[model samples]
Target: MTDTVADVTPEIAPSSYDAAQRRSDAIWQKIESDPSGLRMLTGDRPTGALHIGHYFGSLRNRVRLQQAGVETWVIVADYQVITDREILGDIQGSVRELLTDYLAVGIDPERATIFTHSAVPALNQLMLPFLSLVTQPELERNPTVKAELAAAGKSAMGGLMLTYPVHQAADILFCHGNLVPVGKDQLPHIEQTRVIARRFNERYAGGEEYFPEPDALLSESPTILGLDGENKMSKSLGNTVMLRMDEAETLKKIKKAKTDADRQITYDPEDRPEVANLLTIAAQSTGRTPEDIAEEIGDRGAGTLKIFTAEALNAHLAPLRARRAELEQDPGYLMQVLRTGNERANAEADETLQRVREFMGMVY
Candidate 1:
């Protein structure tokens, strides 16, 4: 176990963003040219049903990468559910729902590997060696770990909470995943994973590269603010529209979303954030600019804006919702897909573990 934080560290290393962005751009080109050369690991904790924020945030990018021929591994991260939460709320159901959401968003089982954390023992075994590579201070200083701990509202954190970043490193290296899709806030976690990979190679692999220093694939999508128009859209905040919501439900949520009293709708994000947020949602759905959308809805109050945003969002989600409905009818297929993924991941993790053991001269 590790101790709690008495002080804060820089959330992200100041100079790393430019370098990360440069590498990300170059990696994007490589992916476009030869996607088969790269393996990407990206996923969500089974906290709850995904919302439109998730859809635009990362799920859409995952679908794009899968379609682009990148080898993708989507981990359910079921074990991570315990890192912050005290009560294990319906995790089993959340796992199933996450699978459905992935498939519903076009993550083809045939193209991507989707597995849960607890299913692969060999992968978790990598944690022991990886943990040894870093000092306790390193773990304590990790910005992601600190932020997560603060979010959980705990004055002191457990070992799992403190070492969450290391576990993530194992998740990537266990499968030798080279690219991780993330937002800027998550870059520090990727940096920590890279450190673990480099350290392991130096210490046990005799300065030979055993694990690839995974690069952060930052999301280019604009941040999707919650309906409150104040914070990022999150399920925990109760300010997001779930992907499974019907048209009526979506409309109800959107109608209740916050917007300013300005009679003439505009797209000035700095000054008119609330109204601009609604416009952004409408723009993303209808494939138009927020400015253009606002112009079309000129002089319309929040009531009309809400209706327009809801209609556009619903229309965009109509196909996905229909696919989800069909999938809901056959629960067995979803479970089978997970079982198959788990088998494949276990095989991969086993091979990686064997190599790690050999590298450290623990093969006897």
Candidate 2:
């Protein structure tokens, strides 16, 4: 781990934490040391409704971290919409709906500040300087950029799409975040941020580490595969289970969900990915081990597993649905949350931008 404070080096270890309690201790320790303020930055692009894959993947952890007293900032990355041409048409509406979903899902404005990428101009300015620091080979190596290029069917990628990792660095460093919650797939982005932060501090902080080398707060949850059991759960793929899905829709999806051909049920992702996907979902939703769920439903047939998984999912989502319904009644309240959060976020971001400008001798 990189040292964020003078003479203080963070410890790096391959954690024993299961999918739930994985990075809690390490995160808490960092927060404890910087109680007055420890910044955390995380966000999603405004594309569509957040699904169960999102809830179980990272948003759930964001709520817990916010409540734990870490200063959290969630950005609605409206600017990233240009990366995927399809989303550009409805990006505005999607941003509004995404904020509504965020409030409904327990991202409290009082506890965490939320803002839109388009609303922050200074943050965007950091991207240009950041681009100069990183090379084309470095950007090309980013896994997400490669995947996105393939997804967009772009044989020759645009410069903006290729340098997204730099934009992500600006997102975190703009807010001076000390910790960022990200999955294994996003580890490279955080790695890039560390390099940028270190380079900036070394060159600009007058020999002092003004910006902390942010640490990755890894999720303990297993990567939630999509309902198709083929790839990661995603809204675009139509394989996601929405967090606010009604009982009927939930059941309908599960009924048609894929499963293994074998008559016997087993939790083997490698050998039987489809069956294992269901078991993983069941385990996560019911707080049971995949093996335990498999044994309990042994020889019951896929129908039984589908029914049970649907019921477990519905039960798990009961509170979130109720909370969402209550929040939906007052859309203005959610807007206010974003408005207030934007103010706070802008204030914090401005502070860092000011420091950066002064360091680079852009202003006296």
Number of the predicted model whose TM-score against the real structure is largest: 1
Query: lDDT tens string, model 1, 1-364?
Result: 0111221223676689989999999989988898877999988888767899889878988899889989999999889888877798999899888888889989999989999999999999999999898889989987778877786689997999888888988989999999998887877778989999999999899999879999998788877889999887877678899999999999999999998888898898999888998898998899899999888889978888999999999999999999898888999999999999999999999999999999989998
User: Whole-model lDDT for model 1 versus the true structure?
Assistant: 0.87
For each candidate, the alpha-carbon lDDT, in order, equals 0.87, 0.76
Error of 2 at 304 (Å): 0.4
State the TM-score for model 2: 0.88
Q: How many pairs of residues collide in each model?
A: 0, 2
- Model 2 — which ten-residue stretch has the worst lDDT? 1-10
